[model samples]
Every structure is written in structure tokens, then in C-alpha cells.
Target: MQTSTGNKPFSCEVCGSAFSQNSSLKRHMQIHTGEKPYSCEICVSTFSQKAHLKSHMRTHTQEKLYSCEMCGSSFSDNSSLKRHIRTHTGEKSYSCEICGAAFSQTVNLKSHVRTHTGEKPYACEMCASAFSEYSTLKSHMRTHTGDKPYSCEFCGSTFALNVTLKLHLRTHTGEKPYTCEVCALSFSHIFSLKSHMRTHTGEKPYSCKICQSTFSLNCNLKTHMFTHSGEKPYSCEVCGLSFSRKSAVKRHMFTHTGDKPFSCKVCGSAFSLNRNLKSHIRTHTGEKPYSCEVCSTSFSENSSLKRHIRTHTGEKPYSCDICGSTFSQTAHLKSHIQTHSRIGIKC
Candidate 1:
């Protein structure tokens, strides 16, 4: 035969693909013609070749004839087993023509090419949102359907995506897999690691369209949007007060419960918030992280440094409505208001 003799004489005029026999060339021409003669009876799935349909039938039969020698992983088809073997072999034969990025699978390379071509074939019917990958579009559909397929084994929490469930599991396991190279600090989630990195780089990618105020994290930018919109979603059940943040609502609950969860070991003092405990610890340690550039003076808290900066700028924001008098500090404004009350002033 011509195949054994290293000859492919039958060539197609369309793509110039040579074949060993006329029958082989005729089968190869079906690719250019967009023809799939073979079809599965069960699913009605069509294939260009008979071997592919034979492999598709195995899925209906639940048959795995081919298996990996390295990991004992099974596949319905031999080509799938070969692709699975590439994971062990670390063979990335497929490369992106534009970026030269390599992938072990042809499917991954095709997805990568879409990044260069700006091709988003997969689209959601609910929101008209598009994605390059079908898997991503499938995940986006969960937002509309309210379907959480992935559930945490440790806790009873459910997530729409498997990756979110994996991140939630780390909270119980106390696993800090992602680490910062700059500070040697660790985080459970990759997003937390990325946000922590922005603190060092001072990179604020998220910007508010209204005020043009930028934030390092997207969550912070979303929270900042509430300031512009005057939207406070989180409400306190105890006092019926609303807050822009859930953490503020949590801190408000401690005021009602009188629960000082954060405790200072040095002075045996307690605080409702963790940040308050951190600030209290700095008093004992004499660690003034916030410094004034004008007078070279330092303070334990950033709020104290901000108040000190107003002294240099002479910026008195707090003003009395009755007297039209302004004070540099709130304590001074309160003292001034007491004078008005002592003099039988209605204000």
C-alpha cells in the first residue's frame, strides 16, 4: 500500500491535503465540505468520520475501553486517553499563533486564539452577556437561575461555582495557599492575594465614573459607589439603622449585644472591632504608623493624623447652624454648643 511505502499520492485541490488512497482523500474532503455522514441514533450527534460516531456511542453505553497507564484514569476514546496522558508527560504541542502560549489540549489553544480574535461565541440568553468559553457562559446562567450546584462538604454553604466553594472551604481548613512575595503574608484566596499585592504596588485599577475616585480592590469601588448613590442596603434589626457595609452592621450588632469579641492581651481591655484592638495594642507598643509630614509628629491612628493635618491647613469642616461658627475639632464644637445651651439659647 502507499501508506506503508511512505507515499500520499491522492491530494485534495481545496486544502492540498495528501492522502495514501482515493478513499482516504474522499474522507478528508468531507472536512472542507462541512459534511458529517455518520450520526448517532441515540443523541442524533453527527460526526465527520465513522470512528468518531463509534466513540460517541460509548458515552451512551457508559463504556471506557481506553485508560491511562500513568494514573489509571479511564476515557471512552483512545484520543481522549492520549490527551489525558499529556498531563503526566507535560507535553504542550498546541501553541497560540499570536501570543505563542502553549496548551496541552487543542480545545484550550482554540480558546486562547479567541482572546486574540475577540471572538465570543458563547452568549447568555438571560442577560445577553457573552463569554469566550461555554463553561463560563454556563456559570453565568446560574446567576439568572439562582442555582448553586457546588456545595461545601465541611459547612452547609452552597456556591454557584466550584472555585467559590473551594475558596470557602479554606476558611474552615485555615489554608493560606496564596502568599505575597513582598511581605511574606499569606491569604486563603487568590483574589485576596491579588488585592494585597495592590497595596504594595499602589495600583488602583477600579475607578468611579462619577467622582473619578480610584480603589485598589473592585469590592472597595462597589462600596464607594454606595456613597454616590446614597444606597445603604445593610440594615440593623436592633436599632433599625442602615449601613453601607455589612461589617458596619456587624459592629452595630455588638453595640446592642455588648459583645467585645476583640480583646487586648496587654491591658486586658476589650473592643467591639478588630481594628480597635489593633489601635489599642499600638498604644502599649508605642508604634505610631501614621506620621505628619508638616511637623514630623506621629500618631497611633490615621484618624488622629488626618485631624492633625487640618491644623496645618486651618480647615474647620464642622460648623454651628445657629452661630455660623466653625471649629477645627468636633470636641471644640461640642464645647461651643454647651455654651449656647448654658445661655438659654434654643440651639
Candidate 2:
């Protein structure tokens, strides 16, 4: 069948998306109407169009109807096969007028154009937040509706997005597709491996304006900024103590509940906090992962490495509140406080 490519005669009334034919517009309308007319016989999976149901059947049957002659690669649909062909031929028909950037598919080129134009065609009616892509807008809409369509068969867990669900499936399957080249370290997600790569590269991209301190991830920088700002958002209800980090508040909750959740497999030692359990685990394993660039010294805990750095820089940040005596370690300052107590007076 000849492909229909010309001025789109039909358009969607709900989202104002243009379509080539009335049939295409009708299929698009089902998205807004929540209507699925076509249903699969095997899985009972429903779709808006008969074509989609036919395509979905291939998943159950494990059939590949279309094949690439160049690479001998098989695909369920002709469109997918056509897109795969571009990889071999290096042919990109869809070109952006603004940037001259070419992409294999017209959809990708359209998404690329949005970056240059700053055009967000898809907008969330609930939040008024606009997105350059329709898929992103669909994900954003989930926040308002609290709907999770994608569900995991393994653990009865549901996710707002299919990609999130896919990642969650890896937890059950132990599928670590993303792997590091340097250390051969595997990650369930690509972003985790990217963040892991920064450890080897020492690439701290996210920086704080307050102290010029950098972090591997943006979230770590955000948490670090809370420390500089003295913003203790997470407050303990039992003790009325505020903490800058939610993890600290979580640890504090264990103190009230007397719940030791994190346990060691080796020695059966238990701890309230995960970080403390990880530190204790190092004692059994004798693993000193954190290393200093200067003098090539290593420590089991990150706090120990931090204190070791003070020896080189002579950075005595901890000060005795009673006697005005400074020390590199807080424990040293606490130990000196005893001396002041014996003297029968302090600052």
C-alpha cells in the first residue's frame, strides 16, 4: 500500500493534532474518549484500532512479519523495519529547518524541533505545565489523577509510566543492561551507571552556589544546599528535633520505635540506619573503598576519609563550646570538654 503523505485533511478536536485521513483522526479520538473497540483473542488486550490489536498479537505469538534485507533484522511492523533500515543506509529524511539536525524518524525530528522553538504543544489541563512531547505530558497528568496503569506481574506493584515499570521489573529479573566499561559494574538503569561512571571520572557536575561544593547527582547537591541554608524541613514528631535530610529524620524515628531494620548477613549485627549498617559491614569485609589522592591512604568510612583530609589541610572546623579550643575531630573536642569540666568553669 502507498503511504499517505500530504496535507493532513483531518484533525483531532481534543488536542488539535493533525492527521492524514478521517480513519487516523477517528483512531486518535479514542485516546481522549477512553474507547477501545478492538480486542485481542489470546491476551484479551484492547486497542483503539484493529491494526494495533493485530500488531499486539505478535507479542503473544512471537512472530516477526517484516524483515530488514540489509541486516536480516526482523520486526513486527513495517514502520519499525523502515526505521531500522535508516541505521544501515545512514539516511535521515526528517531534517529540522532551524538546526539542520536530521533524525531517522519524523517524530524524533519533531521532538528535536521543540528544543529550538521552545514550543510546548502538549499542556496538562490540571497543572498548566506544558511539555515538548506528548508522552511527557501524559506522564505529568498522572500526578493529578493518581493513576498507575502500568503494573508489574512479578510483585503486584504499579507505576505511572511504562519505563518506570520496566525498570521495576529488573528488580525481580535482576536484568542489569547498563554496564560500566572501566569497572564492569552493572546497573539496572542507565542514569545509575552514568552517575557511577562519574566516580571513576571524578566528574562532579552539580555545584552549589553557597560553598562551590560539587556533587555527582543534582539531588545530592540539593540536599547539600539544605545544609548550607540551615533548612531543616524534616522534623521528628516524638522528640521535636528537626533534620536537614529526610534520611536523618528516618534514622531518628528508629530511636523512638526501637526498630533495627538494617541487619548484617555475615555476623547478624543490626542497625537502625542503612549507612551505619554499611559502615559496620566494612569491618567484617575489611573493605576501604574511599581513598585519598594525597599520600594514597584509604578508609572504610567516608567520614574517616574526610577527617584524614583535615590532617593535610589543617582544617579544624569543630570548636569546643566551653573553652574555645578547636579540633579536627568532633570526638577530640568532646574529649577536651571533660578537661574544662574538671577545671570548674568553661567559656
lDDT for 279 in candidate 2 is 97
Q: Please list the C-alpha lDDT of all candidates, in the order they appear.
A: 0.92, 0.90
Off by over 4 Å in 2: 1-118, 125-128, 257-347
lDDT of 2: 0.90
Candidate 1: Cα lDDT at 92? 100
User: What is the C-alpha lDDT profile of model 1 across 1-347, one tens digit per residue?
Assistant: 23333588777888777788889887888899989999999989999999889999999999999988878999999999999999999999999888899999999999999989999999999789999999999999999999999988887899999989988998999999999999999999888999999999999999999999999989999999999999999999978999999989999999899999999998899999999999999989999999999998999999999999999999999998779899888999999998888997754
lDDT of 2 by residue, 1-347 (tens): 12334587676766778877788788888989989989988878889888888889888888999999987999998888989999999999999998788898999998998898899999888779999999999899888999999999988999999999999999999999999999999999999999999999999999999889989999899899987788989999998999988888988999999999999999999899898999999999899999999988999999999999999999999988766789999999888998888887765
> What TM-score does prediction 2 earn?
0.53
Q: Against the correct fold, how does model 1 do in TM-score?
A: 0.76
- Top lDDT: which candidate number? 1
Question: Residue 138 deviation, candidate 2, in Å?
Answer: 3.2
